[model samples]
Target: MRMALRALPLAFALAPLTAALTPIDALAQPNPAKMTFFITSAGLGNGADLGGLAGADQHCAMLAKAAGAGEHIWHAYLSTSATDGKPAVNARDRIGTGPWYNATGVMIAQSVAHLHDSTANTGKQTSLDEKGGMVNGRGDTPNTHDILTGSTPDGRAYPPGTDTTCNNWTSSGDGSARVGHHDRQGGGEFPTSWNAAHPSRGCSQDNLKASGGAALFYCFGIN
Candidate 1:
């Protein structure tokens, strides 16, 4: 019943063009205890097959119901390519299929589009000859962006340079992608902090493309 990581090549390649910075809101907090339940449920439901984007959405809906917060939520899937051991491309393409919200349960700004695999790099073609240039593929992509900023749900900021990546719980532990809060050095409190900071952005997917594959779950508040 474990959650499976899905491959999202399109999301990764278009991330940079879609990534946008937005202001952090101080309200619409997340309930940590509820979030825990959401994560556990998602892990139990599809943590094994790597069902792809559909699995990620199903888990997000489950978390929203468990939290009883709102109908809107942002879900992201993480996966790696068979050729490159890094996160797959365009993981964020699924955003169009569901409701997207920020940490405070606030609808995310239109300008702030979601990136499928923030940790992974967008594959860009630099050469005129599509075949001649180094085609960005596999391990060549950079890591996804950290899920949480340095601050916690309660507004306590972490030391500068926190790991974020859902507290370094990436499917692959190569020090690249993390699963939940993004801040690695921080203590377990990160799960709670992340929930508090972003109730809507709850539920994250980490695909450990390496080591036979792995998946980690995070959730905030029930619907």
Candidate 2:
């Protein structure tokens, strides 16, 4: 019994050392079954077009399903301005009353109010992708810190005249979309705003790429 107790202490001491050497892909990607928040591992590959909000939501769901997180209803963190026949939508309104968690089970926000406020725990480290991988950010070889948001700093849609959503996420070649810095750095009206940093140069694949983005966006589980 004494020998067993001594072994337990030694084993506990070595556990962290063992974990330190574990490959990122092997153990870094943790329980997606409980994930409630993630940046899409991949985009629709159409710049800011995103096939509109429905298509973006579908993309989120598909990626979540692939990552074993399909049990929840996923929504893209996007907003649409009021148009001729359509009412405006808020990105904050679509996602559930938060307490959202990342793929590694790290909480991003405790509530919707918290998420849009200064107290939310979101940034390069906590804002992980669907597979718990870090999205490239400022100072990375090729920066992809600009995350599509299409919402204001408060997470609401812009007024009717603005083309913040890239023509409601349909016209990828003409207008521009508002984007956030997932790394919570860089230049903008609200430079550190995780949901509304600045507008993209334009809504094309090349433009987004050049502007430090790869057409990636945030996703949240509503159920």
Candidate 3:
């Protein structure tokens, strides 16, 4: 009984140290490999007509949820052209303040400004989807590098009286939409611009495919 009683005190005394280390260990550990940025593995299948910003946002949320990232707010990185007296919406404004990371925990950007900089790291290999799969880029079979952005080089909506946004992302018809080269290499005007490579042939899915795209876009966590 005496030996048992003595051993109890030692166990009790060491308990506080163990308890203290628990929190320290947690603090020392890295953040969970949660996906905060990704390219859409697939689009809504209706060409550029993503049913407008709401529908596109919903699509992003749905895909993220399926990839186990439902807790974060997801937004499609697209711009809307001005028409009918409505002001244009910039793609940069929709997504939240940055510091976004991919599924592999690679930091893509620290802020919107950082993302727009010429030296940004959002390339084909880094801009993976929520499932951590690499979207096909230039030089790959079929060449799906043309990611739809609909925004200008500065990540803002095009000027009024223009139709570079596929009728504000509400048309699957004869309109054209701006596309980016996720691979950061192409023959278009902005070949080196990851999100502003050039424009697509048309807004149809078949057209997008013909122009080396799969109708995909980038999705970012806003929270």
* Model 2 C-alpha RMSD to native: 4.1
Q: Residue 14: error of model 1 in Å?
A: 53
**TM-score, cand. 2 vs. native:** 0.89
lDDT of 3 by residue, 3-61 (tens): 99999989999999999999866643323246788888899999988988888889999
TM-scores, in order shown? 0.31, 0.89, 0.84
Taking the tens digit of each residue's C-alpha lDDT, what string does model 1 give over 1-223?
A: 2222233556665775555422222232443222211222224322233244355546556555545533545343432232224433333332343233333233321221321223211122210011112222223343221232212332232333433333322222222332333222222433322222232122223433221112433322212
Q: Could you tell me the lDDT of residue 18 within candidate 3?
A: 100
Error of 3 at 103 (Å): 1.3
Question: Per-residue CA lDDT of candidate 2, range 141-220, in tens?
Answer: 78999999899988999988779999888877999999999999999788898989999999999999998999999999
Error of 3 at 49 (Å): 1.0
Query: In angstroms, how far off is 73's CA in candidate 3?
Result: 1.0
Cα displacement (Å) at residue 164, model 2 = 0.2
What would you estimate as the lDDT of candidate 1? 0.30
- The superposed Cα distance between candidate 3 and the true structure at residue 28, in angstroms, equals 21
